[model samples]
Target: MSTERFVIIGNGPAANEAATTLRQRAPQSGITVFGKETTRSYKPHLLPDVVAGRLDAEKIFASPEDYYNERDIQLRLGQKVVQVDFNKYQVILEHREVVSFDGLIIATGGKPRIPEPLEVFEDVMMTLKTTEDARLWIDRLARVDSVLMIGGDLTSLSLTRALINIGKKVFFIIDAESFWPLPFNERLHQEIHARLREKGVDVSSSRKIKRLTQLSDCSIQVETDCADFEVGIVGAFFGLVPDVRFLARSGLDIDRGILVDENLQTRFRNVFAAGDCAQVYNPVIRDYWVSIGYDNARTLGRIAALNMLGGMIAAQASPESIFSLNGVQVNTSWWMEF
Candidate 1:
């Protein structure tokens, strides 16, 4: 009999956890993980430390190469999975390579969102989503004295402090739309503004960004509804959206994200999804919702793997938690605490 084959799409915490679980349960099964990133799986929450020069980029990987080799898990880094043919049970790569799988897990995670107004300037806008993004900021910071952040998400808040600690002026524009999945209220906005001001950040009163012009000197001229500023760099922190664009027309139900049942399995039994890219069904609410944060992603990944191995395990909804940054309550993951 041929050994069972498993394929995981993604290289973040969720993907790593799923791969580990599969290896543990089905020892004889062939496991393969495809990651779009060239580097090993690392903690994205620690990206601020990388930008601040407090942590070395090399030390960020959660699992070394030996981990996969020892487990006989094939880790294909820098390979993007462009599509999945659920009917044929095949995973298609960008270069048109197709691999058959008995079981599959999609944990592609999320990508940084660029606001509509600033979409044209995406080439010049900086974001902190991947290791490469962090390294880019580290290289660019030496030439930059100040950074203009267009949105104030949890990542933007963390990066704001990191830049300030490095003696770089941070101009923050608070955009309520950027704080998706996290409920944003006027009181919360005021508290965030107050905390940022106390931290020596230039918190802007305007929330709407009207225009962004790339200057000849490689700087950006930002024009908000009520203010204008020229800064050495412009960072867009409009939060993340599901990175499942490639899954379109693949015949999976996708609304905001890939829709899954309580078992973390898609409509197809052999196919499952976890992490930020999945919008899980809530029996109680009679609706679907996406669970953000590291712990939740790991938990979902494990459950998805178990169910794939014939264990019927329903994923529990993770409670919303707030991280306190100097008495300011910010809704985010625990790892986000600086």
Candidate 2:
């Protein structure tokens, strides 16, 4: 007969460290959270140093906003959970509002695989993965001069060192000729591809973009059997997809993720799934993946809040776990000498 009220949906970093470890180990439990990003949950790898301006925007907030209201929790910003009924535990939001729970922690995090004929809004394509898409690619990298980037991982070398330290001009594609393949190995991808082509970043690597279209004066046309350029910005990366569409018609077992086991439980009970969209059981790549990061979303939001307080937890976070990768890259003739 649990009556804890610890709802938590997702605000990233494992739903704010599993609502501060379930409010400091169930201190009368009543966590709340909910957030679909209006704020708080920052540190999405510091949105590439706030788009390489070198971290500002309140130092990528993980706190402050009254630090989750002085820890009483109750964050709810922007909302957007869309449904989880689970017989009657309730969750439904996207304006309809329903939220009632004894222990629901989905920790919703994930969504940035924008493909599908690359939706419009020309003036050069982009997709950096939040912080409002890196502040709209830091205002389209100060109105570009040249920048192609397609994907080589580590966010295309940190957006190719923030567009070669803001001097723009930075093409880079990758279908994989090398770089971070299943976790960097071909000699650390030829030593980070020869230190990113000795800091100039034109690195293509096996190429493969196929189509992107947007000309008519706004610039950005990317084809690629080997080349077709015309950029001002095209940054693609294309990797990351798991918002789970509110458990897609909710049957509750979901394969590539939300499968849960070793207690993080979710064949639908008190209901629980953790950050990066829970595809648990990746004992260092053993399989059953799904990991988006933020310390595996605070270690799967503290093992789905200690198995939602029954205390039979195990998921110490897995799947491609990265911890640090430091940054820096430049080219286009030392852009601005930084």
Candidate 3:
């Protein structure tokens, strides 16, 4: 018998979990994980801490170096898969390196949305999606006394709170009247808003940002339909859309994301997708969503690995509930916004 070769293209929770499960399911198999980001796989919730300097990049790894070494897994960091040869079972990386695999997992995850107004100030405004993004924000913290956040998703809210805790005044603007569009009791959502307000977040809902202008002090002044607000830093967290732009040439099923079955396997039998890059339908609850958060990603990744090994375990869908401000809620995940 010959050992199987597995390749996972991503560094988030899904890619990490899939590689780990593959190692456990087939001890003799060679597992490789390729990540576009150079940083280790850390919890998304810890990104705010990374930006605030509360946790270093090395300390925030969800699956640190030891985990990979203990499982005899290979880590390929800072490598982007430019193309996939479905006919040959090979992937071409940005540097023109070609790697072959028997099974592949596409856990490319999602990218943050940038508003049209902020596009011109590419050097000024920022989005928090990777450790590199956090590093950029952290580098400017010395000159940033306040932050203007322009979304109400989990990423935006968490960064707002983290900045506030670090003594940076935060001004938040959202399209909706409430906070995250989770299944929160209206009262709970109001309570969450009140708590954020008490903690010094200047939140403005139902507002539209027209454009961004540079003030005399090099700070960013947001021009909205209602009024103008100036801040030393500007960040937007309009949540994420699947990073499936690269898969267009692959000819796989893609609508909102790479469509996958209950087993997390894609149309191509050897190729699977998980994490924010996958849109799955759960037969148990008869619900469909673009999976977000770490827990759901892990579940799909594990299920993908099992299905690859001819196991019959189905991907379990994590329930979407009200996201808590104090980090006490479970089954919490965010869907598409705008």
By TM-score, the best candidate is 1
Model 1: residue 12 alpha-carbon error in angstroms? 0.6
Q: Which stretches of candidate 1 lie over 4 Å from their true place?
A: 318-338
Each prediction's TM-score against the native? 0.93, 0.33, 0.87
How far in Å is the alpha carbon of 227 misplaced in model 2? 22
Count of steric clashes across candidates, in order:
0, 2, 0
The digit string of per-residue lDDT tens for model 3 on 1-338 reads 02889999998998999988889879999999999888778887688888877887778788656889888899888899988988889999999999999999999988876656556766567888887888878887778688887766677767777798799888877644223324345574565567668888887766787878767443887888899878888787765778988889887888777888777788887788888788776675454456767777888788888788887777664454423322322233544321
Tens-place lDDT per residue, model 2, 162-201, is 6687677777765442232134456756766677778887
lDDT of 2: 0.68
- Model 3: pairs clashing at backbone N, Cα or C within 3 Å: none
Query: Per-residue error at 28 for model 2, in Å?
Result: 3.7
CA lDDT scores, all candidates in order: 0.84, 0.68, 0.76
- CA RMSD for every model? 3.8, 17.0, 4.7
Q: In angstroms, give how far residue 251 of model 1 lies from its true place.
A: 0.6
TM-score-superior candidate, 1 or 2: 1
Task: Report the Cα lDDT for candidate 1.
Answer: 0.84
**lDDT (10s digit) by residue, model 1, range 1-338:** 12699999999999999999999988999999999999989988889989999988887888886999899999999999998999999999988999999999999999999877778889878999999899889888988799988787778888888899999988888888776545677997888889889988888756577777878455788777787778999999987888999999999999878999989999886899999898887676556767677877888899999999998898776334433232222323434443
